[model samples]
Each structure stands twice: as structure tokens, then as C-alpha cells.
Target: MLFTTCIEHLRTQPIWFLLISSLGFFTILKKSATFLNWVFITFIRDPKDLKRYGSWAMVTGSTDGIGKAFAYQLAKKGLNLILVSRNSSKLKSVSKEFQAEFPDTQIKTIAFDFSSDILEGVKEIEEGIKGLEIGILINNVGVSYPSAAYFHEVDEQVWMDIVRVNLEGTTWVSRAVLPGMLQRKRGAIVNIGSGAAIVVPSHPLYTTYAATKSYIDQLSRCLHVEYKHCGIDVQCQVPLYVATKMASDIASIKRSSLFVPSPDDYAEAAIRHIGYEARCTPYWSHWVQWCFAGLLPEAILDSWRLSIGINRRQGKLLIP
Candidate 1:
């Protein structure tokens, strides 16, 4: 119906006009669903610019949960993939599912745990992806430890493990992939963060996780400013309490959309936004955070954040 009306509208334009502006637009709308799609297919789809970067996405910690969700959605977009996680079996299972469900998209997997030894893992990944052109980088790796203790009482190793997985792994993987993106002058890097960054002073259990997420949040915003001229889009997809094995039993998580989204569901929302049109997303909520960041005094914001961090635990860690 739209095409018909467009054609009718085109016919009404004077022939002299058709030879100019109207014809060019009519030709554009008729040829492709989108202006960019036409251009992409025509010039970038092949050995030429026609197929820019060849639909390869690398996702870290993708053996289960959110990372796996991203792999599935990218497959639908006709992307071949490199899936990474610690568990070889889980990676094989997800990769097999992708192959069976969507035969066209290729799938590759790497199973290296991102504990303190992540740098070695990154080097291995660099070697593995040497010749491939990865157009998308979804940094969905993270870790959350439950049961809070006083900051000093917490085990140092546990705290360090959180940092190694949440911050270091993400940093290393991005570093491994970024040189190519910089050289190509194009790519999308999405780091998963959390709502706690703005609202919580210090979540007893999630202290380190929140800090690393804050790092990712700021890193993405800075990268956007740093790389905007070079045609790179960097975004952080930050949210709260997902309903994975990690957060399933948490009482504060009330609903799906607000608190606990299934990984596939969240990935679907995130995959739709491959461009960094916004510094932060969950568009409305982050807009409010952006405004509050400017408006609220840091002390007042910290108090409010502390309340959110408490969840239902009354401004402290839940005790058994």
C-alpha cells in the first residue's frame, strides 16, 4: 500500500520534476527497503565494499544466558560468529543449536575461562581471529557473587575474581579485537553494565561488580567521544538483575520487563540497537540517570543509590 501511494504520488509530480528530485527519491524507495540497505547490497555486499566486514560477531562468555542470546539474534541477522565461554560442552551445545536452527550462519567457539588468566585467553583469541573481519563485538561477559559481608571481611580472592572476570576479561577481549576495528574504521562494541552504578553507594555483595560496571559505563561513553569521527559505535547495555542462574532466587526481582528478563528477550532488545545513537540505553531510564547525574548532588545521589542497593535487605547485606 505504501509503495502504491508512493508511485501515485510520483506520477502526480510534473515530468520535469520527475527528471529531477522526485525521480531520484522514487528510484530510491523502489529499489530497497531502506536507503542504506540498497547501498549496502549494491556496493558492500561482495569482494567489494558490498559486504563490509562479512557479518562476524565475537561474544565473550556466550556459553549460556545473555551471551548465548546475542549469538542467536546475530545469527538471524545473517552473521557468522565466534562464541567464547569457559565451558566447552555448553559452547558446543549452543553452537550446535545455531547450526541446526539456522544453517546459513557459521559458528565458532572458544572455551577459556576468564579468571585471572584472561590475558592468555585473549592472546589465543587474537591468534584464532587473525584473518577474519569481525564487524560486531558484544562484550557480554560478567560475574556476580551473592551474600555480602563487610568490605574488610570479604575474602580478597573472591573480590579479585569478580574484578578479573567482570573488568579484565572484557578489557582484554576488546583490546584483542579493537585493532582491526580501528584499522577498518568501523565496529560496534557493547559492554553489559548494571543499574546499580547510578543508584547504589555500595551493594554489600555486589560492590566490586558495581564498580567494574561503572568502569564499563564510563569506558563506553568515553570511547564514543574518542571514536565518533572514525565511524565506530560504542555502547553499554546496562540493566539490573537478570533471571539467570545468578539472580533467579533474588526476592527483589519482581517482574520480567522491569527486573528479570530472560536472556533471549534482553538480547533481542539489545541486538536491535547496533548503533550508538545514545550514550546509554533502556532509553528512558538512562535519560533520567543522565539528567540526575547533572542535577543531584553526589552525596544525595549516593544516599538514594544506597537505598536501591539495599533492595529488600534494609540498607545492608542479607544474613542467613
Candidate 2:
């Protein structure tokens, strides 16, 4: 009765009623769209038909972990691959493996260490990929601290390597590939990011790694807006954890699960989301974790992160 009376009263002021109803409808519609977007991302499964972007895909750190996984996934999509990594032999071996499996697809390898002069290495990449219709670039190469430590206790060399490999590598490699993509006027660039990049808790011990990934996140966002008009897509695929050598020091993620996925599993899901979302935690389980984490207060999350980092540091030190 009271609600009915209120509606009747508001109707007398027709403009006010119209404005309130419009605002309510808009808010409901906005929420519905957001819910539908998550549903679409979670349930839909499809292989990336990457030929629309270009004929070939390039992956840095292609010999192992997520980079190798991306290479395999792209090859499965019927695109030729340019494999870039530090080990010449490993690159050759991976190239041979892909050639055997995807017999119809062409494979090329470039040995470029991210820890070296990045510009020089990019020139090598440029030379290696010359005259090729390279359409996709996966900036997957990065380095992390050997173990978690206070910022002052970290070796200076370790800090330099992390910044050089994570920040400089992603920036330079993207630069090397963008010209070809622009000329083609269609391409996709996926830069691997970390959950530590302000997506979850504020990482306390591994400050450098988190900060570098933060750089990647911003770079991906800026590049997306800048190049979307040119038929290119740039995205940062932020993942939490995977059963890979890079994450071996973390005890909780030592084994792969639905949430903490294997590299191959994560890559399969990550590739599907590349051209669609600007910043995404590609695995469905990770999306659930992201949402759950969002509900906790920041103070609690900060303390939890600090404890985990300390435990991980002790565990790493105990290993002889």
C-alpha cells in the first residue's frame, strides 16, 4: 500500500518519476551486461582462429613454460611460428618439435637473451622476422627474483636482471613486432602479466617483480587505445599461478590445479581471451579467485601477502 501510494505521488511530478525510473533502469542494465560478460568469458570455449590477425605468430621465451605453451597453441591454430628464446639449442629443438607435430606449419627460431642489450636483441629479432607476415606477438619473457627478500637485501644484479628482462624485454619486443603488424593493419600482442600487478594483494617482498608487471599492465592498456583504430589489439594476460619453473619457489602453487593451472592449460584459455579483453585473468578459476579476493578488505589482504612472502623466503633459503 505504501509503495503504491509513493508511486502515485511521484506520478504527479512526471519529470521526477521519469528521471528516477530512467536511472534505475540504466543501473540494472549496466549490471546485467557485466554479469553476461563474465558468463560469456567463462563458458565459451573456442580455438583462436589467428589467421585473421596474420599468417605467423611470434613468442619470446619459447623454449619452456608459458612461452612454449603459447607456441604450441598457436601452431595448433594453423599459424606459422617464430620462436625466440635465450638457448639456441633449445630453440632449435622446440622448432624441430613443432615442425614434426604441425608438419604443414613453418617454424623459425631466434636466439635473443632478454638480459643482454635489448635493442641489439630486437634488431636480431627484426632481421630474423624480415619479409615475413608476422601478425601476432607474445611478449612472454620475464625474470623473477631467485627468492623473496627485503628490497635492501636483494642483490643489485638480481634487481637489474628483473627490470631488464621483464620491463625492457616486453617494451623492445613489442616495438620490434609492431611495424610488421601495422603494415599488415591487423595483429594481436599478448603481454604476460602477474597477479601481483595490483590485481590481487599488494606484493610486499617481491617488489621488483610486481612493479615490472605493473609497467606491463599500463603499457598494454595504453597501446590498446592507441592502436585499436589501426586494426591491432594489445592485451596483458594477467595470470595468478601455474605449475612452471618460474613459480617453483612458491610452495602453495607447487602443483597445478583448476585454479593454479599448468602452463599448457593456462595458455589454451589465455589465447582465447587475447583479442577480446584488455586486461584479463584468462583462466575461469582464476577469475573466480579474483572476484573472491576483491571482497576482502585491503588490510587483511596486505597482511596475508606479507606472511606468504615470508614463508616463501624461508622455504627458498632452506633449499641447499
The numbered model that scores best in TM-score is 2
TM-score of each: 0.73, 0.89
Could you give candidate 1's per-residue lDDT for residues 189-251 as a string of tens digits? Answer: 888877767444444445776788889888888887887677677888765555565554333
lDDT of 2 by residue, 1-320 (tens): 99999888877887977898889999999979976888887676564568999899999999999999999999999999999999999998999998999999999889988998888998898899999998899999998888889899899999999999999999988998898889889999999999987566689889999999999999999999999999999999988888888877544456686667899999988878878778888888887788789889999999998887897888743222
Q: What is the C-alpha lDDT of each candidate?
A: 0.71, 0.88
Candidate 2 TM-score, C-alpha based: 0.89
Return model 2's CA RMSD, one decimal: 3.9
For model 1, the run of ten residues with the poorest summed lDDT: 42-51
